[model samples]
Target: MRKPHFELPLHFMLLPPVIIVLIYSYGPILGLVIAFQRYVPAKGISGSEWVGLDQFKYVFSLPDTMNVIMNTLSISVMKLAAGLVVPIAVALMLNEVRKHVFKRLVQTFIYFPYFLSWVLLGGILIDILSPERGVVNAMLGWVGVEPIYFLGDNGWFRYVLVITNEWKEFGFSTIVYLAALTGINPTLYEAAVIDGANRWRQTWHVTLPGIRPIIVLLMTLALGQVLNAGFDQVLNLYSPQVYESGDIIDTMVYRMGLLDAQFSVAAAVGLFKSAISLLLISVAYYLAYRLVHYRIF
Candidate 1:
């Protein structure tokens, strides 16, 4: 029997990427040590006094922690739901449309928002949703309705964040489902039609089933981010008035650590976020495996 050829040179080619990934990814984790120390940039991490869980205790004892956690969960979950459903709905609608040129044009327009930075998009949202002389308010005024403080009011702030995030991200998710949609065998639809399966039946059985694995994968990935409730969007769009509803873990960390100089406490909060993320991702992966035998690994 002939032995299989081993590509030794290919193994050497892989070393550079491995070295880069280790440096860029794993190297930063060393900073988590600050979570245990009374971290001060001037003192340096090693010179800093070790406080252990004192920072963590302080973080939990604060009134804002629970509220921020709730806000983070609400906003993240809402975004996740909208993020999942909108793309699925859009993909289904697009699949139903036989007009290729019009479909492509719509797709292009929707996808444009995904590339826009939050800084630019935030300004655009402020202008569009501005209470005074804004486009949405102006239209509402014509209908004899009162202008809404979409950004300033706590009640409306979370909703606006979710909607804006969906507008920005759903297109990207739609592209994923669209790719999955194209992979569905055309013969399945033809076969369904021969069996007198109507458009709804054909879609119910064929399209959704074909895309189910991808949907599960996407949902699992999304579940991993149950804590990240749009730092950039919230930071850009929100003011102090809406902080009650809009404050999230990342923003809280920024405020506590960078702005407030509560470095150790901020580090502890960050450490907690990382731990939760890891736990959630593991649970999600296990659930996905049991439900659909899905494994990104």
Candidate 2:
């Protein structure tokens, strides 16, 4: 038999994460049986009534089901688009900064919020967007405009979700692109410069091409998250008034499963989401591997 190149300790180092994946990820899959059952807490999985597709039928029969699905898709798609554009733009902008001190300070400021939990930021946003005395509304009031209910009004809630999602996520993504930018061959830019390519032309031709692989990789990976519309952020920020625009599949599931105790219905939704996500993730990973030679062991 051929001997292994990696040391045994390196293999041992992988055990913790593997064990966590098993415990948290695979273990819960056993509970998916309730999706086919009319689940009851007192009766439990084995004892629960097996209703087959009735729960799913009931879910779809509701007036808000399609609305919830549409809301989720719209919000997630907007977030995905913004997530790509904002981060790539910010990274390119920051790359152009001449002063190292100022550049680093700006990076730090933007990246700081990425570390904050949505729970904390939700409270801050609520206060800032408050129509009564919030900073944003106060500024609007100064401009002789009425205070806008960003979180409450259906008209603005989806956009608010997108903006806030970008604010929280763009920094981390920007850092990824910045690292990719560093990996690009400096000779390419030098060659472009020697050819009399101006800054904008150079960026358009050379810079964007250099980062294309990273962009493709990120875009492909993002496909798997098409259904996940910032559950924690939406949960924290949304209200009944904004449900028309802000209610997503995750929030609906939370309401059904936890709040309303419709465990079977929630399970069906979870199963549906998981199935689609698994398919998407598989396709995304395959595309990334083929396109960018990206992979995870």
Candidate 3:
């Protein structure tokens, strides 16, 4: 009885945050009814006409639907691939550095961009990649090449998105991998060297094997983000000219819901995306548990 009473203050301290989560998170679920209704702002949720599956039908029927789906998949998949490979490569390179000061300086320089918001970076990228009067194009001219509009060009936009996303995130992921590398026993390397293994052989046999679990875990968890094409980044960096290659689900929903005032259809698309994400996340967790013995509990 005394044990329960002793924890009362701790329980009270946790109550406010619990209430906030319930209000902000669960409360919005009521708005999901908009997905099945012809929602009208003037009429509100209670008065909105129930349209059943019509909104979803309209969403799938849109001419942009398949293109949006393809765009989302392409960008996200490329991002995931780069996110995995680039970090591992960088981490391995850093691990080979002998000087602590130089290694820390390089880490700081690369990781600096991870702290910058897309809003700021977008402006910087736009200026640097401007078709005219931009540093990138200026450098291209030094080699007698014509100016290239990186952000506006359709064929190049997706690649730019992937490369830039990696630039901003890979440093952080590299740090993660470096931490994993440190966890590998130094004796493992010694054992490999004792077997006449060289640096490359030791790295291949010991270092990579040590980080394999984290790599697999990251890959499995990334499955849930297949539909996320980075809305903030695309919104800031893209224009109408690149919409053919850059437009994704979240941006499409933004245009439909806010710009076009097609709220019900937007809600339908959002709900559809959420359902798929939930499934993928569940599958990802299950695979993680099976493959790497990873579990939240």
Candidate 4:
């Protein structure tokens, strides 16, 4: 048989991204060695003394480590659940809109927030959620309620994280679900309608079933990020006052690695997070494929 020609241009198109990933993503993996070494910048990676798993042990011994881990898990899980539910609900409501122009406008408005950086949103949230002279407090004063410190209070801070994270990201997530909804067969909805199904019934049976694979795919992908409770948002929004509830793995790592100069312990904690995330992602993919026959790739 004759050899077939390879598409050179098509392969060439992928070169830039491939090179970028190799340099930026895969290249930095070499630094993972620091996890096992008592890393010192003055001595450098080569000269840093190898401490084996001592860093890992130290990480486990720290009482704050447990608190940070718990906070990370709690915040991430709540965000994940809210992220899935709120976006799906919003997409469904959008899908129900018969007026195309209005629906598009609404979508544009909602999706606008996703384009804003966490730095910007965090500042805006601080102002809006301020206990004094903020919009929320101003409104509460009307209803004869005391001003509540949403960002500073340990009890309310995690909830604030979840809500703000959802508010910022849900719009983009809704767009994904909306795209999935568009791919659903219109005939299925017609059939359901013919079978005397109402709007809610059609959504529950036909619409949801049609989008099941996408939902499964997203959920499976999200499992890998169960430990990532958003570094930017939390770092920008949280303070020492709410650190008990708001301090996550990333923030803890930042403090240990950058501020406190405990580089090895920080790397160890990071490696632990990566391992857990990998395990969770693997399990999630397996369950999704076995249960729903859904594969993202």
Candidate 5:
């Protein structure tokens, strides 16, 4: 019998990524100690005095923390719902259309937004939604309705965030659904047609079932990011006027840590958020596996 032996050089293939992961990913985790200590950049991580959970204590003591968490969850959940539904719906709609040129044009237009940075979109959004001179306001004027303050109003801020996020990201999600849609065997449609099934029924029984697994997988991955409510978008689009409804955990961390220079408190808040996200992701992954028998790794 031949001896079971692994190729030595094959193992070397993993070394570069392992080293990169350690340097880039694991290296930053070591700085998590700052969550327990009042870290000064000059004094360094070693010199900082430990304050234990006092940072966490301060975090919960704030009245705004509840609002911040609420904003984060609300916006994230809304975005997730929109992102999941709209893309699938759009893909289905596109699939129904017979004109290849029109379909491709629509796809290109939708996907264009995904490539635009929040910085660029922020200015465009502000210009389009500006109360005095915005296109939206002008349209509302034509309809004899009052112009709404989308960015400044606390009540509308979170809604706008969700909408803007969806507008930017829905195209990417649509691409995934479109890919999944294409993978569906055409024979299923032919068989359905032979059985006298119409387009609606064929889609219901064949297309949806074919893409259901991909949908579940995407949802599982999205659930892992429930806490990340678009830091860049929120940071750019929001102002002090709407902080009550617009301030997410990431923006709050940015403000407290970088702007206010409260390193320990910021780190503690970040660590707490990360822990919750990990817990949520684990639960979501397990549930997904139970439901669909899938694993990412």
Candidate 6:
């Protein structure tokens, strides 16, 4: 029998990421103690007065807390649903395109937006969505429709968040589906055609099932972010006018912790969001394994 060789150089290459994770990710966990204290910057974590569950109590007592939670869940769920469907549809359509140049051009154009930061996109959206002279409003004016205040109106803000998020992200998401589509057995499609199955039938029976594992994986990962409703995008685009619809848990934490200088309350809210995300990830993992027999690990 041959003895296996250990790759010492490869092991050395992994050390930097391990060190960074220890310094950044795992090291910050000790600060979670602030959530249980009336944290003061001058007093420090150890010197701060311990208040136990008081911070959490205060968080739950606020009337805005429920609204924030609802907004976060609603926006996240809408983004997740749209994220999944649009990418899959686009990937399927792209798969049917025989012209390589056109397909590649489309993919390039779509994928480019994902690389642009929300800060940049938010600025562009502000100009494009401007009620007075924006392109969207200008188009509406041409159609004899009233100019919609997309970012300012409470009724339309959440929809804007969902739609814009999907538009920016779907291209990157499609890459995963396209990769899965490539992995599908070509013989399966040939067999489907032999059975008199049309393009739609072949897609329904073969292509979807071929990518089911990837779909389940993406969905499970999305569940882990059920509370994260794009803080950067929302913060950049929303004004006081749409706060009723756009204020999410993360933005609340930013205001309470950083702006208001209530570190304890911020920590408490952060801990709550983390707990919910952890619970969701665990449940998603269990469901994926039990129902679909898919294991991310």
Model 3 spans > 4 angstroms off: 1-6
For model 1, how many clashes?
0
| Candidate 2 TM-score to native | 0.94
RMSD of 6: 2.3
Error of 4 at 17 (Å): 4.4
Model 4 scores worst on lDDT over the 10 consecutive residues at 287-296
Candidate with more favorable, higher TM-score: 2 or 5: 2
For model 1, residues 253-297, the per-residue Cα lDDT tens digits are: 999888999888888999999999999999988888887787777
Candidates by lDDT, descending order: 3, 2, 6, 4, 1, 5
TM-score: the better of candidates 1 and 3: 3
Highest lDDT, which number?
3
The Cα error of candidate 1 at residue 257, in Å, is 1.3
Tens digit of per-residue lDDT, candidate 3, span 211-282 = 999999999999998899899999999899998999999999999999999999999999999999999999
- Cα misplacement distance, residue 163 of candidate 1 (Å): 0.7
Q: Please estimate how well model 1 matches the true structure, expressed as its whole-model Cα lDDT.
A: 0.92
Q: What is the C-alpha lDDT of each candidate?
A: 0.92, 0.94, 0.95, 0.93, 0.92, 0.93
- Against the correct fold, how does model 4 do in TM-score? 0.92
lDDT of 2 by residue, 11-122 (tens): 8999999999999999999999999998888998999999889888888999999999999999999999999999999999999999999999999999999999999999
Per-residue lDDT over 177-277 for candidate 4, one digit per residue giving the tens place of the 0 to 100 score? 99999998899989989999999999999999989988888887788889999999999999999999999999998999999998888889999999998
The lowest-lDDT stretch of 10 consecutive residues in candidate 5 is 287-296
Lowest lDDT 10-mer window, candidate 1? Answer: 288-297
> What is the per-residue lDDT of model 5 for residues 16-104, given as tens digits with 9 covering 90 to 100?
99999999999999999999997889999999888898889999999999989998999999989998889999999999989999999
Strongest candidate by TM-score: 3
Clashing pairs in 4: none
TM-score, every prediction = 0.92, 0.94, 0.97, 0.92, 0.92, 0.93
